[model samples]
Target: MRMPEAVTPAEWNKAHEELMAKEKELTRAQDRLAAERRRQPGVRIDAEHGFTGEGGRFSLVDLFEGRRQLIVYHFMFAPGSKRPCSGCSMFVDNLGDPAHLNARDTTLAVVSRAPYPEIAAVREQRGWTVPWYSSFGDGFNEEMGVTVDDNDSFGLSVFIRDDTSVYRTYFTRGRGVEKLGTNWSLLDLTPLGRQETWEDSPEGVPQESPYAWWRLRDEYGD
Candidate 1:
């Protein structure tokens, strides 16, 4: 949504005044957090933890697919686990095209403790082409602390590798939810943005915007 142009000096001043301080604070905090993220201690993967994809088996390094950085979203999708977390489903629902992400020199993939077939079925149903893999065979999901028994929750993590060595760069969950983008950054500027009856949107919430019209990849528009 295009923001209304500030014609008057007062309007422009008011806009900058509203969040200038807060924006500066946010930027500083983000910068510090990113620096700390880059300094995270490495967790080596020595055991045989592999994921199965369409082509064949893939080690954790293989997931990077020769990229400099790898980001894995631990998606909850076990067979007997309670229903898929609506929050995660909603998140993946809004992910921009994988190709867009790929073009950025980063590889984003979903890892689940569920079997390959189960994850594959859900991917097909959701019509998402983003690369997903099953971490069912190995203790990868369990070791990552995302999987508990038959269920798993979501976690965002980054890893890097040079030659044959793998290093965990960063990981975040829960309070880190803000890092996941749902277009709220854009919607927050609108008068009727993200009008989910849930949030206390001061501008009366966005009511059923274009994002709401988005559907699964293979799903047809109504």
Candidate 2:
């Protein structure tokens, strides 16, 4: 084989641009992959998956709560654990009311392996009011592929259904983590918003909300 040619500065710039184009292309392709998965034939939940609901007992279908779309965020909160996954906590911190998603016929819920009693403690500590349910006696988390002992801590997954059928639309982890935040999505609008703090602005920076004003749910009123 012939020896590879050295990359001149000009050639390096060309290569960088080409690589960026391919990155954008790949992002689009991944989005298309999710779309195709959503289009797959829905799967019927024939086996009963148990859960402890506020109203005694409930099954997996009960989790759907009368909606065409369902998004179950598998929160890592096994029994006896003091805190859930920090990365998972970061994603949950970004979530807002499901009403907006509800308007589009989607229902969202956070499922955890912890018993409701333990799960409730954290919910109160975090001041989160999102609909949460316990899967203490069920294999729901394992069946969904989010149950990891110590290796694969947690993951974000989206599921959808129509009538009586359900299907897994998509799931992601690791560097795909950025997909969980709405703040970064907003920062991209301005010339200088991510605050890197050490960042220097040439023509000054945009003003509006002070970053310090943001607070965790538990400390919101304080």
Candidate 3:
């Protein structure tokens, strides 16, 4: 990375204040976007969907755990695979705690096509405490648009429960999934900023091939 020229505190503060104004504007724009997202109309899901978990068979409605809202992370763990997608694993590893979400009447869980036994084994191996379930044979992943051509894909879907009815509020995939990773958010504040080739960093800033640094939290050194 190219080193920034040294400057006096007064000069640095002037530049910092200028950036702060743009940052505040961006924050307001994001808030407006979130408000619009909540205002968007949602579609009701009527078809019965089942999942297998440690607690036994569960229906889609049961996933809310009596909460008003549910967020499902579509984990890319194909049936019989020894390891899940590294990107998915990295995204999930940053989900620090669910209690904060639960406090807001939102429940988050990971869903995959892998069998419960395989899901459980990986959960144990990764030391993750978040709720996870298997959508094998139920077509939940496909119905949710998280599986295409029999290949598992990463996605985040939001649902709302009202009385006996459930509606899908929002869904996103691909790079949109980056919002769930705290690592990227942290890196964006640094000089190099994630070191991805696609980033709009200054010329001569160091960057690595995308996904080269990705590894499961437990297998970081391996």
Question: Model 2: residues >4 Å from true position, as ranges?
Answer: 1-34, 41-43, 148-152, 181-222
| Candidate 3 local lDDT, 66-173, one digit each (tens) | 877788889999999978889999988888656545544567789999999999999999998889999899878888888888977888888877776988878888
Q: Write the per-residue lDDT of candidate 1 for residues 125-152, one digit (tens) a residue.
A: 8888778998876888788888777566
Q: Top TM-score: which candidate number? A: 3
Residue 104 displacement (Å), model 1: 4.6
Alpha carbon lDDT of residue 104, candidate 1?
Answer: 29
Instruction: Give the alpha-carbon lDDT of every model.
Output: 0.65, 0.62, 0.76
The TM-score, computed over Cα atoms with residue i paired to residue i, of candidate 3 is: 0.80
Tens digit of per-residue lDDT, candidate 2, span 1-222: 898688999998999899999999987775444434434444455566888856666766677778555666777788788787787777778887555444334566788888998888788888877777898977777777777553234665555565666666556557655565454322222223333443333244323343543545345431
Task: Give all TM-scores, in the order shown.
Answer: 0.70, 0.63, 0.80
Best by the lDDT measure: 3
Worst 10 residues of 2 by lDDT: 184-193
Q: Model 2 Cα displacement at 32 (Å)?
A: 3.6
